[model samples]
Target: MSTKLNRIDLNLLVYLDALLRERNVTQAAHQLNLSQPAMSNGLRRLRDLFDDPLLVRTSDGMTPTERALELEPQVREVLMNIEQAVQPRSAFAPEQAQRVFRIMASDYAESTLLPAVLGKLRVQAPGLTLDIMTPSDVSFLDVERGKVDMVINRFDSMPQSFHQIHLWNDSFSCLLSPENPVLADFTLENYLQAKHIWVSKTGMGVGVGVDPDDVQRLGWVDSALARLGKKR
Candidate 1:
């Protein structure tokens, strides 16, 4: 492996990381601002170097092979270490910088917070690009692996290694149909009697349980239910 690394160009590792993350040559090219043909040539070279088809085209999309998956962490770590070694500690000039920031956030944050962020970026960092993705179970992993630059979500406990700040305190509001008869007298009994639909992050299942890590995510609903001596 060391001998193979000695023969390979370091830039190929950057291309490989992008390809693995995007799983599409065109998208990866766009991310790196390289032409599609150039990206294709890079992929071909990477295959020859690795002696494996790192990514395979399928009906769904480009899928990473087992070898590619295994290399992901090491590749990301190498790139991150290199970046940290060379990055200046002085104030960043956002206006002059051409960079992409990847953030994983909840649907609510996407709708509410990201618009404000975009507005600020348009004025302060015209050359910067923002890639916003919906948070999944693997979001924290993404952050830890340097695949995502930031994550916006409520958590019971923040990861010790991460730098964290309280962004804002959010509150929930109940919405009801105007013509509903219960609107006149909204009480705990009426609330309990009303059928509820919950959007679960984990997806639909017969009797699947929620992960303990997800408890803080249900805080608003849980607090209301706790007041009524009930649990969801």
Candidate 2:
């Protein structure tokens, strides 16, 4: 296997992976940012190297051959392992590094955590740039494709493939105007009677003390409320 690998250009494996995923010459070319002719040449080289028509044209689109299907997972794993193995091992010199950091975060994180992160980056990595994006439904896909470097979110569940850290603990608190009547006579009845506002981007009804519906959307807040036998 090592001898055979020695004869192959490692980049072809990357191209092959992209081709198998896309199953279209043009789409694979776009993925690798190569010209159509260049991608065709790569496909030709791959066919010569493997002695297989890895992809066959079908009415719907390009279809992978049985050999290509069998090789997909192995090729992806090999490329991923190689990527990790070759990644920088030396201490990161944020002060000297010139790179762009892409982050996917929520609006709440944008208002809270991003300012602090930007402050630190200004001092530590003057040359570094940040591209902070509001997360979408496909944000995890972006992370998987390497378009997003990190995501700051409060998820109910996370994929096992990701590395995560708990940044801080937070609790929800109700804020009322100082002059509000509730301030003078704050009681459970007053709290229950008071009109409330829920700020949600998705227009979902807000939970009073802890919204059970938010358990899947808002991380641990609901669990904390459950511990106290409270529901809003």
TM-score of each: 0.55, 0.62
Score residue 142 of candidate 1 by CA lDDT.
77
lDDT of 1 at 128: 96
Task: lDDT for model 2, please.
Answer: 0.79
Stretches of model 1 off by over 4 angstroms after superposition: 1-87, 200-220, 223-228
Error of 2 at 168 (Å): 0.8
Top candidate when judged by lDDT against the true structure: 1
Q: What's the lDDT for all of these models?
A: 0.81, 0.79
Score residue 55 of candidate 1 by CA lDDT: 97
List ranges where model 2 is wrong by over 4 Å.
Answer: 1-13, 16-24, 30-78, 176-195, 202-232
Candidate 2: pairs in clash: 208-232, 209-232
Per-residue accuracy of model 1 over 100-206 as CA lDDT, tens digit each? 99888888878888898899989999999988887664456577567789888877676666779888887877777888777878887787677666667677422
Pick out the ten consecutive residues of candidate 1 with the lowest summed lDDT.
204-213
